[model samples]
Target chain A: MGGDFPRGKSAIAGLATFGVGEAPGFSSMELTARAALLAVEDAGLRIDAIDALFICQPDDFFAGLSFAEYLGLSPRFTDNNRTGGSAFMSHIITAVMMLEAGYIDTALIAYGSNQRTNGGKLATSIKPNSWDAPYRPLFPLSSYALAAARHMHEYGTTREQLAEVAVAARQWANTNPEAFAKGPLSIEECLASRIISSPISVRDCCLVTDGAAAIVLTRTDRARDLPRPVVPVLGAAAATWWNSIAQASDVTTTAAAESGPRAYHAAGIGPADVQTVQLYDAFTINTVLFLEDLGFCPKGEGGRFVSGGTIAPGGTLPVNTNGGGMSYCHPGMYGLFAIVEAARQIRGEAANQLGKIDVALAHGNGGTLSSQATVILGSADTL
Target chain B: MDGMTGGPEAQWRAALADGRFLLQRAISSGTVFFPPRVMEPGTGETDLEWVEATGLGHIYSLTWVSQKPPVPPYNVAIVRLDEGAQLMSRIEGANPETLRIGQRVRAKIGTQDDGAPILLFEPTGH
Candidate 1:
């Protein structure tokens, strides 16, 4: 795979988010359409200018066709790949490829979900294996719990270390005005929270909120004329190892180990060059797992690396500067929001914006640490 | 029920009713996998054979799921069998909070709500 084909060739021209915290009276389609329209307008482009559409709607069957019909667009190319939350991150790579290959000039990647409003009933739940379903594990959650338990057992990662992830996210959330859970959070509070699954408390999980996010992508040359600062797609890659945690070769590690290196290689940069990171933190353990897998620290050293406000505000390496899904908002699929925050950090428009981020990394995780996708975005100066 | 069926899952379920644990092994790669499939994973080779499991394994990973009032919490675990095949099951005859990873376990058949036999594990007490 020529991973560098789209490096610095494609750029995100516009980004928009709607109904992030709560969209009580809106449908998922409505949320998606509104965000799509806003994203087009943000780029100073009309609705009809979007020649390519990439959408992943968990609640809708044939999501691409349905979204096209709802938004009244006849795109020349479309993709509705559903790799869980990471689908949008993977879409960024696809959009870049389409733009570079001359298949489409403008790509609109979008996602929306009303899981919170629907009482947390996800229309598409990750189906456990037949042998595992009989035991009635609380899917997705239990899978992560198992990984956390194994991580603790094999590497001596303490619960306090795990709780630090939540504390850090909450600290960042306090500064983000659009964050849903701006209230103070402490490692003590996290440790004392009721256990939803062993080794993972209710506090360890992400907030369920109704939200939608969309980003408009075009060639870097065309992006020069767009309204916002051009955040070019420097590199992108994705990988999947297993469908269920039981089948995973190593529960403690994720496919990010594969995707991260490939993405960094494609971008012609290493982890040290990344000023900030936005990882898909569906659970506290997720951040720990991704940090280690993405080469932020040595393997099995993530727990120690995140301790003592390292990833918190004023930390060494700013992570989840937008509060992340754990505090900001997680509407079923969160990859789009991760990309949105990465762009925000690069554009110096994040609620908790860092200082002059030249390069940012946005990584997405899907299923039970199953699918992993890494996207490296950089400002014009890097190119 | 007779242990006779055209599909792998049916055969496995019938064997469970008779209190026997079975796993599929790929003939080409000599690799064992769970949730009996028609073809081996990765290679997709249809040449597969059923073999008796050792009924002894260690807990590779585990989690205790807490429920609302009146519903007791249950343990969900992944057991790595001695034959090198791992599966998802529950540890019986022990408190979930007291269990630890790498603890030895022995397989036992348990019945589900509809009287369908399910494979479970209990502490080996070593």
Candidate 2:
């Protein structure tokens, strides 16, 4: 089981976010810079301490080098990897590798988007005008909905089961202060929401938010010396089987099927060791799919597993403690937030804190469930 | 509009314009691919033939689009073609909500906003 596994001695030292929603006229670049500076401050480190930088090219707007120049910081290692929303988690894995290999000491990963303020609906034509354009899929939502419909067809998954996800996310959001949604939601109300696409209601989709998040990662020795609590990396992995949803072998499953087990195996822990989960819930269907694929439940059983509030506040498993994308801020990609929330949970700092979290798993889903990345974090005691 | 003008994309488009659905079949592996590729993904073989698809398949998956359709609600679907390739298209002239997975469908040629020939599917029984 030990073939080129990372030692996972790197830890998240600092985390920060800004411009949660509707940031007036703030550009993505500006919001990103603000968050980067805040992250450095949270780590109690000077701007010069960062030697590596990783940033996402959200919606083809910015690159790592351009952002590095804009931020007026020169770095030795840089990556502008855009694997959809999951890019941040992938960056964390990269940073850990670099840290282990003596390539860099401190790595800062950041993401920012103005999806709401720019009036850019993700449903707009985002793909190249191929032969498939005539089909009018409306991008990701329809792509995801198509998969959801198939899930129903194959497993008899009901629409109410999907609504239960929205309800649970809102229930969690009620306790989070920085979250965009902080109200009560009912299963019946969720079902009554307008259908964006069949089998997917308006409530099923993530919030279109204008926000940014940043985190600082360093060697465990350095992280421990920093002012903030340390959330040590346990294991990380990523995989992608297809880019286009149509080409996926099984629409009901995702790359998480590969990434999840690999990360857990690398961490030397099973699903039973995970105390909390920060799964990317861009859609309710996503949570259901991950719950099954990530080994929380049997395949085709996610519909029943999520029903009856199994993942809600009082449930045995507390997922998406920060409300998740269904109610929390989605911006464009919810990947970074998953890691940020995971770190918060590992440090016992989450607003809606779950009791005695020792090990936390953050699963990031990108594209139409095309790409996936998983990162497991543990507290100092567990490490 | 003949075959020699463009690459795989154009070849498929030209074939579709001629009322034929085209897919790439690797000569060595017998692997068929949709959205027409120049090379086989598995063997990376350039020795591929533009085989005609029967335009017959069942719905592998489908979604009902309730927003911003040129018309009203429409179905965007992935049809697992009889040739063992899958393509993204829509069911033509059928109620999207009524469409079911595994429903048999046949390919139909359609024009895009730019007047490019594209492929769509409709229930075979309809």
Candidate 3:
């Protein structure tokens, strides 16, 4: 992988999210169209100006074509690349490549899901693995529980540490009005919650909600003409080692170990330079594993690193400022929200906005800790 | 032999029916993998051979499924076979609450509700 691939080549000019918690009487496509139109409007561009479309819906086949048709778009370039939750981050990489190559002028990445109102079963198009199907491990929760169990056994990570993640997320959520879970959360409550899977209480899991998010990407020069600050794509990279948890060589680690460094190298920045981070917190263990894999802390020290309000408000590191999927909203795929929140922080427009965020990191995880994608975005000064 | 049929999975099922557990080993790289694949992962070696597993390994990770009444809870575990391959199976003949990671276990072929042979595990040396 070239270190300079698509570095600072493109910027996100506009982003919008619709149906964050619940949007009754709205189909996934309708939600996507709503967000897409809002994003184009935010960029001060007409919907007809979107020359490229990137989308992935769990229920739709050839989602890009369906979304393009739904929005009355005949984009010259379209991508329906599906890596589960991390697909949106990967879309950013592809959009940057197309923009830098002059294949397309403006690109839109969109996603939507109605998993909550339509019942909380994962609306994934993927069939169960023949080997794993027989065991009936609860889809993704059990896979994450297995990793949590292994992490505890190997590193002696206490349950208190896991509870802290949910607590911190809820604390952040209390500040965001759009957060689905906006109540005071304590570590004791998280530890006492009903166990959905061993070591993973109901509190540790992300919300099941209806939502759609879209972001528009264009060349940095064109983005400069837009009203919003140029949140340049400083770096982007993705990696996938295994699709199943049983196949992972080490359950305690994720592919973020591979994607994180590559993205950082592309951006010419390290973890130290990041002012805030938005991690795909589908499960509390995800934050622990990703923090270690992304070089925020040493391996096996993630449990300790996140404890003691380290990632909470008024903490050393501000994480998931939009309340994360664990509390804010998780509509099947949560990666796009991470990017959306990162852009908000970079543009100084976040609801729980931090001060002077020059650089921010957004990490996305897909499948059962399978695919990992890292996107490092920065203000124009960083370029 | 129960008339071994279909692909690698079918062969694996036949072996389990005969009260034997088997895993695949790549002939070229000597890497072992589970769930019976046509080609070796990572190495893409098609020339693979089946070997009888030791049926002895430790629990790499374990989780107990808490079910409502009328359906009893069970344990789902990833066992690291001594052969270096890992597979998801349930631990039987032991209290579900007592199971923990890193505990040594032995495999046993148990019949499921459908009368199909399935792989199971029980704590060893107890």
For candidate 1, lDDT tens digit of each residue in B5-118? 879988888888888888999988999888788999878899988898889999999999998967888899999988888888999987865788999999999999999898
Give the count of colliding residue pairs in each prediction: 0, 0, 0
On residues A248-291, what C-alpha lDDT tens digit does candidate 1 reach at each position?
87999999999999999989999999999999999999999999
Off by over 4 Å in 2: A1-3, A119-125, B1-5, B67-71
lDDT string, candidate 2, A112-228, tens digits:
878788775552235724645667787778888988998999999988999999899999988888888877788898889898888899888888888888999999988999999
Query: Residue B46 lDDT in model 1?
Result: 92
Q: List TM-score per model, in order.
A: 0.97, 0.95, 0.96
Q: Compared with the true structure, what per-residue lDDT tens digits does model 3 show for residues A305-337? A: 999999999899999988999999999999999
lDDT of 2 by residue, B1-126 (tens): 243577888777677788888788998888888767768986679988877788899999988878565768878888999889887888887886467888999988887788877787889884
Model 1 segments more than 4 A misplaced: A1-4, A123-125, B1-4
Give residue A188's lDDT in candidate 2 (0 to 100). Answer: 90
Candidate order by lDDT, decreasing, is: 1, 3, 2
Binned by DockQ into CAPRI classes (incorrect, acceptable, medium, high), candidate 1 is high
Say which prediction, candidate 1 or candidate 2, comes out ahead on DockQ: 1
